[model samples]
Target: MNTTINMTGNWKPKLMIIGTLLGAGVGLVTASLLARAAEEGGDLELNGGDLLKTALGVVTTMRSVAALGAGIG
Candidate 1:
């Protein structure tokens, strides 16, 4: 009976941690930028169309990133 666990090829958790940190960093930067813009512009108003466009752009970017390395050897 083998009770030992293999530590090799365990990359998913590492990748997830890195991805989470990167996502948090990006969110912080985005929030900071928005705050600065709002402060300088007096008021920040986002219409429905603007929000929809931004959502679509983010989805497209995420899809593109997810497709990376799909065709690589």
Candidate 2:
């Protein structure tokens, strides 16, 4: 008599889902802020006021994503 068994991998689905969620969240926040700033009825000047806030937001997103990737690695 002989017997056979089969197995499937689930790592791809799990990682894909997590990555999608994280990316979407970060992208959403960044896009919304950028759009609002652009629509605030004013000339575009990213070198003065509001620059810090914009920088912080982008840096924060990068840091979080980096941390997550580091942890995964």
Candidate 3:
């Protein structure tokens, strides 16, 4: 009795790695964009935009990888 959830084959780990890399790339790109703005005067304002962008990236990456996996399987 095989208890595997994936019917595509032994590609679970590889897919996971790809998903992780995708997420990281997205997050990094977002962060870089946010960093483009230089600090003004003396103090810099803190914002949640960067965090939100990274979260979006993670979600986007996951969805993309899931879609790819489904298509392949």
Best by TM-score: 1
lDDT tens digits, residue span 1-73, model 3: 4344554867878867976898699779866665665333444556799669867986887688678656652
Assess the local accuracy of residue 9 in candidate 2 as a C-alpha lDDT between 0 and 100: 75
| Residue 41, candidate 2: alpha-carbon lDDT | 57
Cα error of candidate 2 at position 18, Å: 1.2
Q: What is the TM-score of each candidate against the true structure?
A: 0.77, 0.44, 0.47
Candidate 3 — which residues are off by over 4 angstroms? 1-8, 39-73
* lDDT assessment of candidate 3: 0.69
Instruction: Please report how far candidate 3 places residue 35 from its true position, in Å.
Output: 0.4
Candidate 1, residues 5-69, lDDT tens digits: the string is 35589777987898899989988998899999999998998899988998898898778877763
Q: Rank the candidates by lDDT, best first.
A: 1, 2, 3
Worst 10 residues of 3 by lDDT: 37-46
Q: Candidate 3, residue 21: CA error in Å?
A: 0.1
Q: Which ten residues in a row have the lowest lDDT in candidate 2?
A: 1-10
Structure candidate 2, residue pairs in collision: none
Task: Give one digit per residue, the lDDT tens place, for model 2 in 1-73.
Answer: 4433233678667878987898799879977887888889565556765778867987887788778656642
